[model samples]
Target: MPRLNETDRCRAVGMIEAGVRHTDVAIQFGVHRNTVDALCRRYQQFGTTRDRPRSGRPRITSNRQDTYIRVVHLRERLRTATLTARNIPGLRRISPRTVRNRLRERGIRPRRPAIRPVLQQRHRVARFA
Candidate 1:
């Protein structure tokens, strides 16, 4: 589920400030009572209901790196994502699946080459004759 937006947060806070019960506020918003309680607690503690900056792992690739991947894939359309991931400078550490996902984000899909049977010289000669 998506997080509540600023408008919704403000409205909920307003209802709380206007003497509405937390349960009532939750019912009105169609959210859980705990959600309302948390929002009110956040308002009381931080003086704002806005979302705080969350800490997590930062991105390994930047905009430039993403563009480089896109361009390389465009230049060599037939190359597998594994090969591209292996050959690109500074991208050797990323897995092939990650590379494929990045390309998918940019609307590029690396397809495997179609398989065809190898024809012997006798078969070729027979077909030509």
Candidate 2:
């Protein structure tokens, strides 16, 4: 079932307080009757109807580490993702793909440095003439 935001949960609680039945509130809000009951129980347990913290997969790197990655890439614009990943002390164990993903998130795209053939002054003069 889709989750309700704080505002919707608070409104349902208000409806329950105003003598509305749980089923009626559920139908009006398009949520499950059990959800309404749970929201009420949550409000009774905790005065506020805020959502509890959810535990999800932890990030491979911290915000500081991400900033450090951005700084390293910014300082050396031509550096490759694999090289950057290897050089950062904090990101030693992380994959180069993760480093590239981080750079992509920051609007930095991975690109090969431009390669230009060397031309002597005589070559340039001959081409112009």
Candidate 3:
């Protein structure tokens, strides 16, 4: 499940503090009753607007400013080329499924409808006048 954003946390807190029932808060937030109860309990315990820690995929591209600059560089370098899963130095062996994800992270993508050759044999051609 996705973690709640600040807006959601604030909304939940505000609604709870406004005397809304936990079940009502859960319905309003589109979360399970237990989640609403837990958020209310957390609010009562912590008395702060800060979100609790959540477990999920760890962050990549820790330096966001540098990562954005690197993405720009990658885009400039790869713009004219057909970027397959191969050819990226550190990503040459990356899986086909993950290639797009890497490209997405780097803000680069191959041109759609990648080039393909069309061949016609002379024997297959019909005689013309």
Candidate 4:
């Protein structure tokens, strides 16, 4: 199951604070009792339902740059990643593969569409046969 969102987390914490039993809260939220316990503990410690800062190398592209990338690709859906990479002013230094990666993150994939002749009524009858 997916992790609970902020609303669900806050609701769970509220119920726990209202003197609801941990197991009962868990049942009501459809989560394990330990999950409820941990959420309460986190609330007590941090006093916030937001996630902690994650450790890793930061992204190469800013939100604006990513938006530019998406827009450029959307404008020319059939454009190759190599061409798209050259098109973006800020992303020109990055690899075409990186451009493709960003596009993939936004659920855009470039593929050679299937090539088939359009079917007429005779072709449809032949398929049924």
Candidate 5:
């Protein structure tokens, strides 16, 4: 499941700060009581709605993709990060990180090796004894 965003986290914090019980917050957000407590603590520390360090697969995309994502911060460009041409416009939405990982997995990087085939002269320089 995707992590909660800033807005939702803020809402959760507001609900908690408003004297809502921790268990109730968990039930509302489909999380554990500990999660609610953590959210509140993080908000107190950062003064913003943020989630604690979540344990899971680390992001595959490097920081390059982060910069690229911001530079190309448009729905169309973001959607086409992988340079894949698809017919179905709204089939599936992938995170910018996913696109970078896919490109890496396919070895479709920006830099490419330079190669040149040497020519062999056979007919013109045929040796006759």
Candidate 6:
């Protein structure tokens, strides 16, 4: 379910402060009673119902590294992902899958070069004849 916005949170808190029961506030707002209770508690404790900043794992590669990978891939369009990953500095610890993922982010994809049999001079001359 979608989370309530600031306006709705404030209104719910206002209704709770006006002596309305938590269940009644939840019914009026079409939210769960726990949601109303949590919002009221948050308002009482934090003085605001705004979301706090979230923390997560940091990226393995920097923007400069990503650009470098893109540039190298552009210069050597036929290079395999494994070879590309090996050629990149500081990426020796990363796998070919990681290299492909980084390139995928930049809208680049690896593909095999077209295959054709080698044509000798006699074959070309016979074709022209």
Best by lDDT: 2
Best by TM-score: 1
What is the per-residue lDDT of model 3 for residues 1-129, given as tens digits with 9 covering 90 to 100? 555677997898898888988788777777888877777778789986677688989533235433433454465654433344334444125344444555566666634455767766965687876
Candidate 1 lDDT at 68 equals 79
Residues 47-117 of candidate 6 have per-residue lDDT tens digits of 99897778987777778778877888899898877886677677446667877888998899965456799
lDDT of 4 by residue, 13-126 (tens): 898889999999889878888988889888999999766788998687778877887888788788777776676777338777777778889998854346799988866665
TM-score of each: 0.73, 0.66, 0.52, 0.58, 0.42, 0.52
Model 5 C-alpha RMSD vs. true structure (Å) is: 14.3
**What TM value does model 5 have?**
0.42
Regions more than 4 Å wrong, model 1:
112-129
Q: Give the candidate order by descending TM-score.
A: 1, 2, 4, 3, 6, 5
Clash totals, every prediction: 0, 0, 0, 0, 0, 0
Candidate 5 local lDDT, 1-129, one digit each (tens): 446678778888999889999899888878778877888888888897755477999754456544444344343433454343222134354554465555555554422224667667764585776
lDDT of 4: 0.81
Error of 2 at 69 (Å): 1.4
